[model samples]
Target chain A: MELFQEVILRTGFLALTWGQLVMWAVGFTLIYLAIRKGFEPLLLLPIGFGILLANIPLTPLMTPGSGLIWRFYHYGLEWEVIPPLIFLGLGAMTDFGPMIANPKTLLLGAAAQVGVYFTFFLALLLKFTVPQAAVIGIIGGADGPTTIYLASKLAPEMMGVCAVAAYSYMAMVPLIQPPVMKLLTTEAERKIVMKSLRPVSKLEKIFFPVVALFVICLIVPDAAPLMAMFMMGNLFRESGVVARLSNAAQNELMNIVTIFLGVSVGATMPAATVLQPKVIFVFILGCAAFMLATATGVLFAKFMNLFLKEKINPLIGAAGVSAVPMAARVVAKLGSEANRKNYLLMHAMGPNVAGVIGTAVAAGMFISVLAK
Target chain B: MVNLESPLSGKILEINMEVGQQVNEDDEVIIIEALKMENPVYCPATGVVKEIKVRIGDQVNEGDILAVIE
Candidate 1:
């Protein structure tokens, strides 16, 4: 009878705690949402499964050498291979034509970084260490891989919470952007019609990636790995001779990295690490950082209008965060809400792409200051 | 070298310039599309549109001549 009790006690069913059950439910919920609602399913689905695999009591999945999931985490994530590969795919898929057409948008992209730094200081006031705060604040930029890449390097312990915050905020771009956008501007400001974009030449389009690599890398060498891979991918797309490579990067490369990255990232969340007071602070600071980025973009656009004879629709300013299509779509939707005829999607894309490059450069700057 | 302008490799949705139109620099002459983004091919130099090589709904390749400027 005593031996039978010992065997029962050792079994996973008997060993499961209430907290573990709750965590399992939460993980399942995330998976459900990702599948049913399409909430970043590309990343979230794998992440949810990883979380489920990690949380089950008595599972050997993360047990040092014996765990399959744990082995994946160690190989792809700890070695810092997955994020850079994601950057390579992103580089291949991005179009620099809009940035080339209006090179001045680069300044708007640069100006948007003010929000990230400003939030960094705010995180410091809330008692986070400068490095930890810097990583947390960059979540506001709404660039998920960049956030994961930075947090993994600087404060690996904070990786799960920081990534969750970054992606959650990125997915919430439509929600978080508009209220701040409405508060900062009036009906007339939202309705402001901008001139159509000037035609960008194919030669100029081809020249942009090369020039960007030179100028941005020369200015911020620490960001070279991410920036160089991104620009090289863009070059592949623009070069007109690499259709097969470009398609592979956009589809195959993106899908593979996303699975590995999502799983490894989810596995890092070990409950104890993510349930801390500091983790809560990370989420709050992330919101402030994003709000500040959108505000800075809008304010800068308003300021630029003072210098130009022709005006730009300030709605495009909100797209200065690196959320890509989501941010650009938000800008267009807001414009249409204010005026029926406003079609600003293409116009907003110019600043949206600029925002991506700008945020990468800022990440390089942060690594230079904090990592070393 | 004779400068030739055409839509990038994609579907040409609309042709806005004719063979004899006096095309100026920056005028939208042809529309090519990919990834749901419609990109306009513009006149690179101020001149007469000597040829209209592609019609509506024709597919084009990068550097293919949609028009000639001289």
Candidate 2:
């Protein structure tokens, strides 16, 4: 009788708290957002599962070394190991041909990262300290894994909130980018069409990774882990000989790592830690950072237009966010809205890939200055 | 595994190889016009083209076999 009573008492069914329940609800909301709305299901689904597992009463999922999920969180996420692995997958999937086709798009990539620094100052103004501000500022980059990796390293306590903010904002790129893009460019600028991209030669395609490796590594050694892995993946793809390696990186290796990365990152959000005023600020600041990034890209493109004879389509500027295909599609959709015949997908891709490189460099910068 | 299949459901514009012709991987075995893209059905494996399934201007699906290599 006593054993039965003790078992019942110790069971999570008897110990549910309001806060935990609220967290469970938030987890479900994330799942719904991913499943029903189709907002980054590959990431959000695993993240939602992590949130659910972490909040279950009496579970040691996040207790470190005790629970299986907790072990995943500790060895993979907390130590900042999984993100770089995920970068390998991302690198393999990336094609730098578009960026190679139009080398000028590199400037838009650099311009987009200005928001990260600007937001870093803003977070500092909010009294989050310099390291916290750097993590917070990275939300503007709209690269979830990079933001999460940086936040986990610079300010471990802020990891839960900052990661959620970064990912949510990344998923919301379509919603957030349009308003900022519309605000920055004139109707004529939106309608302006540039000439078709010159067909990039196979030689230039091969040369790109070498130049990028040298420039990015020399300029930002901190970004080397992510950028180097990314460039290596791209090099393997472009090299035309390593079909086996590229295939593994793109399919088998990437798919395996993404599952682990998504779930472990989601597990960081414990109710006791995630539901705070600072978290709210993280979300707010993250939105501002994203908006600032989009606006910066558009405005920079406009600035460049003042000197160039051939008009550049400013809509491609918004592809400066590192969301890759999504950001590029948003640019194409917006361009179509302005003019039906405008085919901006290929054009936007140049900056879209460049933005991925840009964000990695920015993260490397933050890590160099603030990593403990 | 090598997948020697037509890219689209269109007639083969031309067949440059025969049943005994040796070809390398990614070598254009057939060309099919679909939409605006000149879809080239490349040899997925480096081997002798052992069979040709269709002549020029025959419709094909994405998985429809155009030829066999061995």
Candidate 3:
């Protein structure tokens, strides 16, 4: 009888707390979103599973030194390994042609950073420390790897929340951005049809990554790790002689690092750590950051139209939040809805890709200014 | 002889011209949807559309053969 009672005690039925149950629901919700709703399946799936693993009673998955996930978090994130490697994969897949074709769109990308800076002050007002606020503010940039990179450096405690906020907001771009874009611009501005992008030459494409690498690294050395890897991957693609290497970076290396990044991030949040008022504040601030960023981009584009003879569509400005093709697609959709014949995809892509660099630079600046 | 290939990667949104229909340079023969915008693919040369190998909603990669003309 005593043996049976001891076994029952070890089974976790009575030991499972209400907090862990809530965390399991959170994990399953992510899984459901990934599977049923098709929301970032590659990322959310692993993250959801990792969350489940984290909450299991008596499990050592997140135990200080011996747990499997702890090792991954320690070496991969704390040591500053996985996020930059993911950026390497992203670089290989990215095509700089559209951004190169319309260099002025880079301004829209820079303008979007206004949201990040704005959020920094807001987080500070909420009593988050300087480093914590900087990491939280980066959620506005809407770049996953960059957010994780900064979080791991400035405030490791917030890594999971910041990553979740960044990615979820990114997936919700279609829903979140349209309302803001519509509220900011008129029918005429949205209907404006951008001219087809000029064909970017092979030589120009080749020179872009090199010049950007040199200039950005020289100015913001703190960003060198992520920026260097990103540019090197781009150069590999543009060089045309490293097709095998580029393919591997884009497909294999990207896939591997993504798995680690998702799980490690998810594992950081046990029910105990994340079930707080602070988490809700992070999520709310994240949405605000996105809104501020989107508005800034669109407004900046409108401001630019005041000078140029050829008026660029202000809608493309919202693509500067660095969600890659997703933000650009939302811009294209809005433009199409406004004018059936308008094709703004390529134009939006200019700011879309530039936003990637813009976000990385913003992260670097935060790291330089805030991180001790 | 000429083959009309996809100039960009995207889903086929519409096939504007039927096979055996006459087409000219710059004629919008196919529309591809990418980045949430529909981009028309023009006929590369003036000729009767000899064959159409893609349908609306067919995902295609750049340089994939969509049609042929002679």
True contacts kept of each: 0.00, 0.00, 0.25
lDDT of 1 by residue, A1-372 (tens): 999999998889977766666667767877997899888888778887877776778878889877887777778777777777777788787877666767667767766778998999999999998788879878878998888878877888877778878888888998999998888888998898666566677788778888888999999998887888888888888888998988888889889888888888888776655656677788888999999999999889889989978788887888889988788888877987897446566667778888888888888888898896
Q: Which of candidates 1 and 2 reaches a greater TM-score?
A: 1
Ranking by lDDT: 3, 2, 1
lDDT of 2 by residue, A1-372 (tens): 999999899999988888788899999998999999988888889989888988889887677658888787778777767788778778778777678767888889889999888999999899889988998888888888788788767887777677778778878888999998998888877887667666667788777877888898998888887877877888788888998998898889887878887788778777888877777888899899989989899888888888888878888878888987778878877876786445576678888888988888998998887776
In candidate 3, stretches whose alpha carbon ends up further than 4 angstroms from where it belongs are B1-14, B19-29, B35-70
Chain A TM-score values for every predicted structure, listed in order: 0.95, 0.96, 0.98
Which has the better lDDT: candidate 1, or candidate 2?
A: 2
Instruction: Identify the candidate with maximal TM-score.
Output: 3
Error of 2 at B39 (Å): 17
Best-to-worst order by TM-score is: 3, 1, 2
Question: Model 1, residue A359: what's the lDDT?
Answer: 84
Give all candidates' CA lDDT scores.
0.80, 0.81, 0.90
Off by over 4 Å in 2: B1-70
Query: Cα deviation in Å at residue A326, candidate 2?
Result: 1.1
State the lDDT of candidate 3 residue by residue for A104-209, as single tens digits. 9999999999999999999999998899899888999999999999999899999998998999998999999999999999999999977656778999988999
Model-by-model DockQ, in order: 0.06, 0.03, 0.24
Worst 10 residues of 1 chain A by lDDT: A339-348
Question: Against the true structure, what is model 2's DockQ?
Answer: 0.03
Better candidate by lDDT, 1 or 3: 3
Clashing pairs in 1: A92-A233
For DockQ, the strongest prediction is: 3
